[model samples]
Target: MRQANGDVRVGGPVNNRDVAEAHNYHAATKHSYWSVRLGGHFLDWANKPHPHKVYQGLPVVPLPCDVTPPTMAALEAVAAFPSMGTSIRNLAELAQVLFFCGGLTKKKVYPGGEAQYFRAASCTGGLYEIEIYAVCGDLPGLSAGVYHFCPADFALRRLRAGDLRGELARATADEESISDAPVILVLTAIFWRNAWKYQARAYRHFYWDAGTILANLLATAAATQLASRIVAGFIDTRVDRLLGLDSEREGSLCLVPIGAHSPAAEPSEVLPIAPETVPLSKREVDYPLITQIRAASMLLSEEEVRVWRSGFAPSPPPPINRKCFPLNTIKRDALPNRTLGEVIIRRGSTRQFAQLPISFRQLSTILERSSRGIPADFLGGSGTTLLDTYLVVNSVENLPTGAFYYSPSEQALELLKEGTFRRKAGYLCLEQGLGIEASVIIFFLADLDRILERYGNRGYGAAQLEAGIVGGKIYLCAYALGLGATGTTFYDDDVTEFFSPHAAGKAALFAVAIGHSARVPGRVKLLAPGAR
Candidate 1:
């Protein structure tokens, strides 16, 4: 049974043991050249959970079938961070945003009875563990309720039928963005779905995968003219209970409140809900570390939530007395005319990158545009970021091969060291061939010690989430400019060592490789099911 405050009656309180467990897990999951070889973990294909969630009894509300293409330019969408403006208003706009961000975009078939369903954002191990749920107030073509987005069917299954935005507002400690929003999207991760392949480290994938999806969601909202803000600091129990999630298996990761200008809904009673869901697989394996980390990071009380949401100032960039190579970016007018929707539909992770160089303009455009910062409550304000980006350049016209740190504030790359290190790049990225083959590798590093001190363990999630969002934008921009990009796993400490003493104390959060793809034309179709 669920309580009025939205806590499921679990056995006992999670305590210091849980926090210790999470810490141990993080230490254990770090990949070293030797650790990877010794682990001997293999994918258990036979027990793979169904990628889609199915609710048996809920009424299905199909989103508009004919979604119009957004007219916002791809680059503009990546850079747009609107606040307190237009609302989503109707079902069509909502559908457009949802489809572009998380809908099933394509189906791929491999030789030996293997088929993969790909979405707009790239996922590690191609395991789609993230799930999207919408909690909203009444609007055109829909009613107030909590609904689960069924991507396979392009519909939402109503889980609880009522205006539940108030519960969310409370969960977030009345964060202005959420209280004023007409619609809130909660992204959750199913542990076993990803852990089957990633093992204990699947906990990290939870935020990485969700971050990529948020990247698309934020851009799509911007393209459709809806103001969006991410709410990462919330009462975890209240949210999980509000969504009827079993905290042990599935839990809320982050919340996105879409639209603006609506008055805060009056507080209302949230009734108990125990919706029946189809089993993801015949059986499920439990990962205690996942539950422990989530519980440890959770803000237990509304007061705690409010205090946590106050936010912290990121450490200022190191003194810039040296010569900074300013990026030569293309003007907005000269950017490709492709719309964000069109680019997302055609976007895919590059499986194989050609050993050719991309123009400096292309690389500069991505850096200059995507680093504008995200609009979120945890960031304290727009134009602030929790992570810093560094790069290893193997090939780019007019730029020497070397290691550099991207100073977004100066719109320049601070050259740290100069020389070819493609082999080292390949080694740092967990020995992936994509590292050496791609034209350049971007590494997102953060000062975890400072972040954790300021925001506690939850800051770890915030940093990883922000990195994934920025990396995802790079994917869209790369595809928009006829280049290819793919996210990669890395040897964490080794990455810091490679870019030392500049990146010395920072921890590597995420990495992406960008260049031209070696695949044949038309081998993988990127168009939506019925589009020109």
Candidate 2:
């Protein structure tokens, strides 16, 4: 599978057009320490794209204002993966889920005409590029239709007023979860929205940003007793066409089926749609690589989607001779008092950590609970994951400062090397101070050789996305315990090397820092009354 330029050749038996495209894109966009420094990329603030997507001709159906706030304890919500027996039968339940996933949560104004709007989850560069749409059957208060969620107005714009879930089910190859779903949420990304800042790398954020939002959405659904699972394998063009998307500028990324209902409506005639949308920017710069990668990863037909969804099981890691310190986790009954909704409303990326030691129990709870795994189509089963976690202990009580590997199978941490690597941790994380001061810096890595060999290039996205979802959970988990956490960028190669021998041949996928905040301020309440 190796190519001349060191790019993995993704054209074997399971490898298809999409796989090859992903490989080419990945090879071209990789970041080396020197490559990033010499790129000389500069942000053009004047050309920044509009954050919110608006449809001009559609009549809006205002969602129900009465949303039931979630009361489930934060840790319980993180650990809960309710069965598909539960259903979201009303508009109120749907409204609550959407609000917590993407609704505006906090607003702040700064001097010099600057303002920042925070959402339910964090995004890179604070650039909200992901847009959500819903396809569903008739519910208690909502009629069957295809609708776009407008976060700016908190309304759903009717794009096509009819049950379109059948089309989506077909697009996903009649995947049981989507076919049984009363409502399916389609997430898309507008290339220029984030590309304006990160350029071609924005492609990765397509999954990262969406994954973070999914973390919140999944938890919110579970808290409300609605069954939910993320569906990543689908016919990309079919989904885009169903949503009337112009694939050049914007494209579909994933489908999330929420709640269970009766069998899917019989496949219906898909009508042609070309709704007028407000232009995002005066001028937009096109990144060819982004489009190329998206096209390459797309499964072209329902048959192809079916074949693609036959995901491979990742091989278990090689055995190691090391003492494993099993996690000492608190039971659900003994979890912190704060609810998941409450924690999300107050969660923010820690700007500065106070170099203080956190209890070993706090760190262990985060690992044990968040690592229970996510419910997604790509994963083989519940509690199964594509990424392995590694941590650098900086200041956790009862834990010696060192680099360690977290064994999810054993629910324990295996000591890799014992030493004071605070300075090395900071350097690996691009010299960020948070890396040195945090109680623990967690890194998510994966064996790309095995991943790509088994699932092909699409597995690349599956790996990074799972990392973000897990990382986002860690963010919420830390906040529930009254500690602070933040996701950070890192020198990827350096991370694998820092945890070398144990993390040998594994590629770094994501990183998050957990610690006490330097400043403790009251959380700003932004939800409407009774709206969590």
Candidate 3:
């Protein structure tokens, strides 16, 4: 038995040349009417994995307590990106970025004193399985080292003692942004932490969970005046080894470099060290499919990474002169005055939604801010997003009750059909009222065939992560406008069919519902940042 990324498991790596494994894994994990009803999986509360990663007996580096978060308006922040060559930041600013990206925001106490400590970004099932690490050169108030961010206690523990940005450069094949960056943020996922609930499907959630955190990080970075870019192509084994990660238990998802214009370090020896870690649960169950898929998607060498990175090539362009509604964003003065930090603290998954209507301008504003473009490697220039947003409009002022297509580059909404879809919307979203009662539901659809062709098996993760990021941005935009929003799983094929013809050959990646909150009292107490 072999596993993905060369792990010891019950299967061999999926062959990328034929794309058989990519298609099979996606098809196997899809939710259908019968699949949801007959799938016998159940949560084992006794063995629920702990969310935090705790390393035993390590020196703690406490971040600055008085660091102030960026005060830019949330909407503005979403559209903001710093010019890459000019920005330089210190420790205090870095502290602020880490906090806003994954910091402890509030405590929600349910009945019987059951409590859930929510972080800055929204996560699926509130399982904070995504872990953030920073590798940096010496900066003001901080030293050069590889460090892991511990959100539970609001501090960092040095994982390796020395500057390793040069090592990151080598792993990424000297990606421009990464090579010159003062700091690189590496995001990884702990399998059992989420697999305890989602099983084999938890692999996809790795990127989804990280995507939400990234949405926050990008917005906060923009507001913090720090330039950042997402580097998706990297040698998996090298990066995992550099952080001393046990690749069987955890693997790097993506590398994000911050700031620039510094000299790139030459690659040095990468020694191995394994520090003991607190066990996540009393017992852990291995999901062989995850291991297999991970191994299949990995780039084994620098030459392979170079080829993978180069394949981002050009994505297809959108239709020209198509009849589309030109987006009408709310004037800056009328938009939310709330800052990025305030919006993040106030944001949460809306439980119930009212049938109240939201204005078209609000929807327009969301598209405008979120569509400015993600500074990412997978996306090439204009109209290169792997995902396309489709909407189920149930209750929106001046918009018909039907499905629609959104063109980010054109900044327009093209109506797919004009008819009531509330009942159909509910049925599609795994039968949830969150879909039926919302002002609009945004569904991200991607050409998996094209993505896989361009990015290899690993492109599967990239597509899913991109959806999660956009879904996250929609959440922030809705919250900034005092609306409720939630991410949901849907009957994958049904979504494609519902918006068919226009959505032909495209697969659904993720979905989000936005509208007025029902505000069911006492379910979970809300905590605003200033008061919390």
- Name the candidate, 2 or 3, with the larger TM-score value: 3
- For model 2, what is the alpha-carbon lDDT of residue 493? 79
Q: In model 1, which range of ten residues has the least summed lDDT?
A: 1-10
Per TM-score, what order, best first?
3, 1, 2
The list of candidate 2 runs beyond 4 A from truth reads 1-20, 111-113, 331-333, 520-532
Deviation from native of the Cα of residue 407 in model 1, angstroms: 0.8
Checking candidate 1 for backbone clashes, the offending pairs are none
Query: How close to the true structure is residue 465 of candidate 1, measured as C-alpha lDDT?
Result: 88
Give every collision pair in model 2. Answer: 18-296
Ranking by lDDT: 1, 3, 2
Please write out the lDDT profile of model 2 over residues 86-125, one tens digit for every residue: 8888888888888888887776555554566778888878
